[model samples]
Target: MKRGIMLLVVATILWGGNYICGRYLAPALPSNLLNTVRWAISSLLLFGLLSMNHKRLPLFSQWKKFALLGFVGIFAFSTLTYLGLRSISAAQAGMISAGIPIAILLFTPLILKERVKAKAWTGAFLSIIGVVILIRGEHAANGHSSIVGEIEIVLSCIAWGIYTVLGKRFGKTMDPLTMTAGAAVYGTLFSALSCIGTVRLNMIHMTPLAWLSVLYVSTFASVGAYLAWNTGVKIVGAGRAAPYINLLPVWTVIFGILLLRETVSILSVGGGAVTILGAVLASL
Candidate 1:
């Protein structure tokens, strides 16, 4: 239980910072390219870690499914998220991305044919309402806010929903480390290819701050967080492990206010509280 709690905290912190880093770094690095770099770095790091354990890469039979999982989870999600941060604050992105658990709850019933409690739907709806309130609150204040940013994040949430379902379907048979490594590798390749025409190679022209932000995200957010989350989750069952998600937006709100100097209204706080309350009840 202690281990699970620690992991949950670590995952949320890394994830929150990832949005901030993307926002800081996006000006210098194109979204797709930034994602590609992080995945490539993470892939190499994970491969080295796995190889040290004398674990050979999974054979061809496992490789194909792993590749697809990586594509959807890493490639699709990261690409859209970084792109979204181009116009949104890291805190705002984190808050918006907080709706992911609700998406997972909704998708599980439809895709896995699992029964959902009424409380779960109520929580999910409340969370969606929270997201709507937060977005409108921010947009009403700024004309420069990009519609594309919200669209990208929303799609990223959908991609993340797909990733979670795929993980549920395939995780039983696949070693998590191997799955992560494979996903990072293939996702990097795909993201790179996707950005071929748009991504600039001249990262040297980027400010030192941007380079540092990229490296931090690649090392800590992408690689360290992934390894930590898998290990932490292993120490706890997924069911008992799930409800920690309710805390993510709270942290995002705190961090956003403290670090980013982002404005938050009473409505956002109310919405976030209601959303988390619903998630907690639903997870119950």
Candidate 2:
């Protein structure tokens, strides 16, 4: 249990770094190209790990399901996040991403054909209120905040919610590693297809810092964090592990201030707190 808790903490921390990395890379790299590179590397590593473990690759057998998961989770979610980060502060993006759990809860009914409880509805309401407060506070405090960026982030959250629902529907028989590997493979393909006309090899330029950021996102955030999270969930069970997701935004906020030198207002903090609370409530 203790080991699981530690792993979960590590997962959230790595994922938090993803927001910072995305923010730093947004101006330097095109979103589709970054998404392609990120997932392509991740897919190779994941598949190699699966091969080392002597697991059968599911891509051929479950191509359709993986295609959908890859499109929504990897391509849409990641591309939108990178595009959104181009305009929004990492701190603001972190706060907005706190609504992901609420988005999942709301999506459950529609995607999973499950009925939501009143508490979930209340939690969704609180999440919406918190998002509104966060947006208002961010707009007031930072001139960089963009409504379009915020919308993109919200859409990314929705895409992730749908991905989670669909993953659950399709992945009951598969292990976490296989499921992740399959999705990554198809996601990389989709991202690469999206980059065909727009992305050119000569146009891509990166400093050492940018390369390091890409490595961080592709390895640490994408593969390492996911493996840790899946192992943690297996050990601690999903319900116990769910709360740790709220820590993602908290870690992102810390990294933003320390690494990115981003500022946060009192209202933003308050709003983040409310958003996290709603996630907690919704998970229950």
Candidate 3:
């Protein structure tokens, strides 16, 4: 259990670093093209690993599930996030992320047909209120802040929640690795098709540093972090493993300060704390 907790802590930090990478890349690179490269590289690497192991993916009959998973988990989440990160501070982004469990809880009843208790509902309410506070705080302090960016981040949260709830249903028949690969394959295709125009017209003459950022996000954030998370979940069980993701906002704050030189407002910090507390409550 200790080892599992350690693994999950590492996973959450790596996952939180995703925003850092997106923050670095969003200004210089086209979001769709970067999204394409990350998903494509991750999908290819996973497929290659599957090939080496002589493991086959699901048949074509499962295309619907994979497609939906790919759209929500990869295309929508990454695209909307990068678009928002272009405007919002990484600290603010972390605050938004802290509310994801609440977003998941809000959708669970409709998607899973499972009702949560009143405590969870209250937790979700607090999380939404926390989000509002965070947004208002950031908007007042940051000149570049926009309601548009905050809205996009919240939508990204909703997309991820949809993917999570749907994964519970569509992922029952497959192992974690297999399910991820399945979603990744369709995600790669979707990103490729969506970014084709951007790739052809605007994807030229990027600096080596930008390329490095793309590679880092593709391999470390997408592939390594996901594998670590799945392994942690296997060791600890998904229930015990999940709350570790709340660590993301904390790690994001740290990295945002050191790596990105972002300053966190007092209200942002308070809202983030409230948001994390709400998520923990809802998840319980």
Clashes of each: 0, 0, 0
Itemize residue pairs with steric clashes in candidate 2: none
Encode model 3's per-residue lDDT on 11-97: one tens digit a residue. 778878889988888767777778887888999888887888788987377888888988898888888988889888877887898
Please provide, for model 1 over 1-284, each residue's C-alpha lDDT reduced to its tens digit, 9 standing for 90 to 100.
79767986787778777777776787687778788878888888888989898887774667787778778889998899988888887666766776777766777777667888887788778778877887776777665777789889878987876676666656677666877787788888889898867765685347887888888888888877766665555566444445665555666666767777877666656665665666566666
- Which segments of candidate 1 are over 4 A away from where they belong? 201-205
TM-score against native, each model: 0.90, 0.93, 0.92
Best by TM-score: 2
Model 2: per-residue lDDT, tens digit, 20-107? 9998898678999999899899999998999899998867888988888889989999999999999998888888888888877877
Ranking by TM-score: 2, 3, 1
- Give the C-alpha lDDT of model 3: 0.79
Segments of candidate 2 deviating more than 4 angstroms: 1-5, 200-203, 233-241
Report lDDT (CA) for all predictions: 0.74, 0.85, 0.79
For candidate 2, the C-alpha RMSD (Å) to the true structure equals 1.9
lDDT of 1: 0.74
**Winning candidate number (lDDT):** 2
lDDT winner between 1 and 3, please give it.
3
